[model samples]
Target: MASFQNINIETQIPEEILIAQIMQLHESISKLESLRPCKQVNSLFTRLVKLCTLPSSIDIEALPQEVKEMRDSLINLSGHAEGLLEFEFSTFISLTPEPFKNVTLFPYYGNYVKLAHMENKILKENGMVNAKKVAFVGSGPMPLTSIIMATHHMESTHFDNFDIDEKANEVARKIVASDAALEKRMKFVTQDIMEVRERLGQYDCIFLAALVGMNREAKVKILGHIRKYMKEGGILLVRSAKGSRAFLYPILEEPDMVNFEVLTIFHPTNDVINSVVLLRKPKA
Candidate 1:
């Protein structure tokens, strides 16, 4: 009955109980993929998510060396498990010669559907309902975001998906290869966003995936590349996390986008794990 409803956001979670719960969650999730369609992932995080919703009060800056090290290790394991789950599902779908027919069966496919609606709502509010060309950096092996957006939201827009892994791009390409409509609108590029040093001013919108930079330092570096190439006044959508969700995904901070004007910030209180940050590149 370790409950956090009465806990103050400013106070730390009981250290011993926190550590033990994390250990249990870690041990259980270690045997399973992080994002399984089963109840396993949800059951594991149900209680933890409650506590994590308001951010862990554990002050990483004030922690003892041993406690901090242990926390980092457990968090890394949790994050790695999540990445594996996405890869696992993507691999399964890729094996199906024509993945699009059954791609919606993806365990977390509904997440992207809701996410698409959220992004569309945001874009409409910002008067960017009809983007001509879009780029999704770190589109991953599945490319769910681009797939959902291209197929449903911006049906007329061209989507260019970028991934550093050639194999991932290959899989993503196959997912949309059978659909002539998608094939005509979506293109997968096997390249890192940082290497595309030329001014990427042609894109009307750009999306930065959660896994693009798993760490703060890496995220900062990638943002620099984006700022340099992103069209002046273009829109950039970033996926991030808040509170204990940081254990699975990197949290975006204001410092990361000092040059860009952040327009909106959203963190779903429901099962949706990602927080959305909308930003606009300032014209010099």
Candidate 2:
């Protein structure tokens, strides 16, 4: 592996080497349950992160067509493997009596803990007390954020986990089914976020997952749908990326959020992968 210390990232590094490493990372993510190569995954990811953040010299759009294509490929494949990791664990946890017992086995468990704290802080500062209902859009197989909020943060708040995939919804349901109390407060729905329009107004807060839309244009459309259907005063917490983190997730820009008032954006400088933007739908 070549040093990424001070060269033009786009030109100095051989494209073949970069592609090979990325494919290796993808494979590593797939076999995380068995392989669990923590150190290797961390090193590769950190280098790629630095590569993505190297000064304007790494103008992605101006790069060679092949490299540009690889850049997109890296983002899409990384997101796919991330979901794959979650699904793998979700299936395992669904079978266990205590779903969270093995949660720390996942490399990104701390990230979820950080997100839960961030959500609690944002909701508290905004006087969002005893939220009647909260909806988490694009909630995948392991609705950890929702589960964490239900048990640790907002004990009384009811959560609706929405996913487009039926199998994912089934697994999520099973994960929450073991706890009788959580089973009462958490519900998993196998429906697209776009189809939840009629029931959107009932939610006091809505969370947009990181992988909901893989690109900026798609994110804009999904946010538009959320804003159109949700209540005027509803809070929308969107998972986004900043700086190096953009390599793994789509970055949501302010210009795309025309109608929503940005309350606060928390960009964690730590291990948290996604930057959270807390917004509210302004009254018409």
Candidate 3:
């Protein structure tokens, strides 16, 4: 047998470091195995990265200092997979929605809570059931959350639900129709938010859960139009899938006295999905 070059066992890492690296590798293997191919959604890669690399509350930058010795043994995980797109390369991925098995509103969560927590927070704070008016934009399945929350105490509030998607509008109508408490208080409409400027400021409070994707320019234009319907100090509730202070800053900087406040953040444990961001438009 050929004599092997003298190996320096002393240079080897400690056992704990080796174990941590192995654990991280196992996590990555599980994630890759669990990933399914789906084409309908745009954020698939970002979702995959989150699922593969992060825990619900992981601090991405600092590996537990205790485990740092094994750093070289593990892959350095990035926050989201889209980070890989800076280079001109393409990779394929897939996603599909399985039937959601467990559904209920609890302190932990259900789809409704994912959708409604923002509006509920505001209503509880303002004690605004007596307030004359309220509006909802994009009254999808989630608007029911707001309607149900409003029904709890508001006796004489006018609720308007608006949507441009026929499918969404139809679904909202059925949900609203079934609710006796909400029937007198709520109305559903199929219309674009931009086209309804004439009725702006007609409500004391407005709820917006519209999808304002990556297009910051469009959001700015829309906010400018929203100024018309809001009363001098009425509140505008906003929830979106995308949250960037930089994108929001331009609209908020407009000459109008309208102010923005963060209501609450309802981030889901599902990393492959976007967290919900809630905001308020202040009259001051």
Which one wins on TM-score? Answer: 1
Per-residue lDDT of candidate 1, residues 5-57 (tens digit): 56676666675566566656666766664454456676675555555555454
Q: With candidate 2 superimposed using the best TM-score fit, by how many Å does residue 48's alpha carbon deviate from the native? A: 4.5
Candidate 2, residues 1-284, lDDT tens digits: the string is 75456566455455445445545555554455532234655565566665554432233334567654555566786666567767888888777768756666655777798889887888789877789899999888888899888888898999999999999998888877877888998898888787778799999999999989888889999999999999988999999876545657888888988888999888775566778898899988
Clashes of 2: 0
lDDT string, candidate 3, 1-284, tens digits: 21112323234333333334345443553355322323412234333233232322332224465443333222222211222321101111101121111112221234444445545555567544466877877564335445555654455778888877665555445545555666677877788888897686788767655343123356656665776556766666544332111111111222322345555554444321334444445545
Alpha carbon deviation, residue 158, candidate 2 (Å): 0.1
Per-model TM-score versus the true fold: 0.82, 0.81, 0.50
- Model 3, stretches more than 4 Å misplaced? 1-111, 123-129, 153-156, 210-214, 240-284
What's model 2's TM-score? 0.81
Deviation from native of the Cα of residue 164 in model 3, angstroms: 0.8
Candidate 3: 10-residue stretch with minimal lDDT: 86-95
What are the RMSDs of all candidates, in order?
Answer: 4.2, 5.1, 13.2
Ranking by TM-score: 1, 2, 3
